[model samples]
Target: MSAAPLTLTVATPLRVWFDAVEIVSLRAEDASGSFGIRPGHADCVTLLAPSVVRWTCTDGTTRYCAVDGGVLLVSRGVRISIACREAISGDSLESLEAGVRSRHAEEDDAARRARVEQLQLHARAVRQMLRYLRPHPGGGADGPDGPGIGANPR
Candidate 1:
């Protein structure tokens, strides 16, 4: 006898990847750990990790999706919805792995760029502060030795 079918939908920040797909089983990774979802399972919610979510289509074909992190909601153990920042679909495990690795590398590069920009902003702030606190060239009131900004009155 054929297995029962469950409807699946995966939504990301950009758009929806899956729309009412009929699947026989689902496998995913959450904070609690890896788990499986089958027809007639209890209704629940899971916080997905950066991993691949696999499922068996009604035709018995396996499919996969790469999710960085997100929430998966199951309603009545039949309708499943996933919300995430990023999600990509693949027809095979190898393709999913490649997609995930590429995305991970992109994120790392973006993070490095952000760190460099932050350091440059900090350097500019420090230079401006130094200019304001430095002694005036003419030893005027603004000088540190004078009775003005940053001056030491003894």
Candidate 2:
């Protein structure tokens, strides 16, 4: 079967990358619960969480990305615009993995650390919603007061 085409727009620091690819899966929050969108989905808008987004290339290569928090707009023709705090492209999985590791190593001072802590709280709430909406591979939903999605959930 031919793969369905979708537009993915990623916004980051001072730049936005737009690409057309085959959308493998999309998970977002709706009023009812978390919902997944595939090809030919209805046009809608919803809040997104800090979670992994997976997609497949025409060559059957699957890629993964991490989205912090954002708004997702999906149109009938598979056009999606994601206005997110951060989006890590799935291309070059090794490089992406390494980048994530390097990013985690940087430590901020007191004030910045406080702000990050606050953001982490918000991210955690989003993650919980995601879990409730769509449970991940091997676990139950996180507690309400659990750490943020990207934070150390200890």
User: Which runs of model 1 end up more than 4 angstroms from their true locations?
Assistant: 1-4, 31-33, 140-147, 150-154
All-Cα superposition RMSD per candidate: 3.5, 21.1
| Candidate No. with top lDDT | 1
Off by over 4 Å in 2: 1-4, 22-35, 91-97, 107-154
TM-score to native of every candidate shown? 0.76, 0.54
Clashing pairs in 1: none
Query: Which pairs clash in the backbone of model 2?
Result: 124-148
What lDDT tens digits, residue by residue, belong to model 2 across residues 69-138?
6778888758877777776765766767766655555534556888999999999999867765553444
- The local distance difference test score of each candidate is 0.87, 0.66
Tens-digit lDDT track for model 1 on 3-104? 468999999878989999999999999988999999888999889998889999988999999888999999987888999998989999888888888888
